[model samples]
Target: MSDLFPLTVRDAVASRQGKRLVGPVNLDLSGQGACVVLGPNGSGKTTLLRLLHGIARLNKGQITWSCPKAEAQRRQAFVFQHPVMLRRSVLDNLAYPLLLRGVPRKSAQTEAAKMAERIGVSQMLDRPARVLSGGERQKVSLGRALICKPDLLFLDEPSASLDGRATREIEDILQSAKSAGTALILATHDMGQARRLADRVVFLLGGQVHEEGTATDFFARPKTQEAAAFLKGDIVEC
Candidate 1:
């Protein structure tokens, strides 16, 4: 009864300030694996992620989950592009989610230590989280999200400010989480990152899905001109 899956979005649409942003889109997600979302600027990738994570209200259509809406909400976590740090020590920041779940502080800190090690932030556990650099804060954000052990994790440009080594560390952590049965929906413009982490791909352009398929097919045999152009590093106009 703890499982949250078979998340379905049918003809979903969203708008902000009277301007259409995303959708007339359909998406189905179940089981476990990484689904990487690829799109250029203004393609509504973030909007789509927000929509799935229950942050943004839908203007039309339906989003259904196999479990109850509240259950699904509880089983999911989201890591934003620009992470906001709490005015607390790194260790506390990482342990906060578990603490909220009523786990003892010491027990939560122990789990937080393990997650920090996974994200390569164990050395900074005693530092004030808000004083850390952007990339370091992002690491803590990811650690906090992963420590909760959600069924699905939504990440938006998670490694944007990370160095090569840090990016690899984060990717490895994501893979480990996937092996632990947590599905991932990540949005990034970094094609290399997509190639490394994606099991499936959803390519968006002009607030619409230009292509959706297995990573293999989407990269090798894109079905749409926009997708083909995007894969070939050409500008995708309209």
Candidate 2:
């Protein structure tokens, strides 16, 4: 978020074993708030997020950010649909990252406890993270990711298979993150969730971006036939 505006991508592409999975994508993202990536299964939503986060290599294209590499790396965070937890307590899991950054033990514990409260996991702080339920683990993962106050956050199918209550909690957390000047890119097939969180929408189909526009514009009138069919709840083939 530190003047890292105008994130540029040119001819972005991703492939595996010579099979293109996502790409020929180009984007310019700036400012704060959430940018939602919407599409059905195998539409390259996950692949796109991974590629943007540097977790996956792109077969072609250039991505440039104005910020320093060290700054971006330290201020970026990613939370997956199914979060992996450590064997330690939930509080310990939250504190571990801070400890690695050289935060004092007492400060780390205090911040972890505070984050637990903020994310509605205060009661589970002492419990082993590995023993928590799926919803609880996801909450902890979100808290852990946000504990550092990241400038950019990425979420892929964050609410997949989660109950309504859990999903709402995640949405609320996203709202808070946006308010704190954290830029977010979330990928999901849930149109309702996309409507709630997106400032902009990126529609992917068959490893390509079918459409990109404001949430209001894209949802009201998708430019492509594929996007239109998708919004109407019809199945589409890439």
Candidate 1 TM-score versus the reference: 0.95
Report clash pairs, candidate 2.
none
Q: Write one digit per residue (lDDT tens) for candidate 1, span 1-238.
A: 1367777889999999998899888887764589999988899999999998999989998999998899889988999999999999999999999999999999999999998888888999999999998778888888899898888999999899778877887788889888888899999988999999999999988787778889999988999878888888998764
What TM-score fits each model? 0.95, 0.97
| Alpha carbon RMSD to native, model 2 | 1.1
The alpha-carbon lDDT assigned to residue 38 of candidate 2 equals 91
Candidate 2 lDDT tens digits, 1-238: 5586667888999999999999899898985689999988998999999888888997898877788756666778999988999889999999988998999999999999999999999998899899887788888999999998888989999888988998999899889989989999999878899999999999988888889989999999889898999999999988
Backbone Cα, N, C clashes tallied per candidate: 0, 0
lDDT accuracy of residue 32 in candidate 1: 56
Each candidate's root-mean-square deviation in Å? 1.6, 1.1
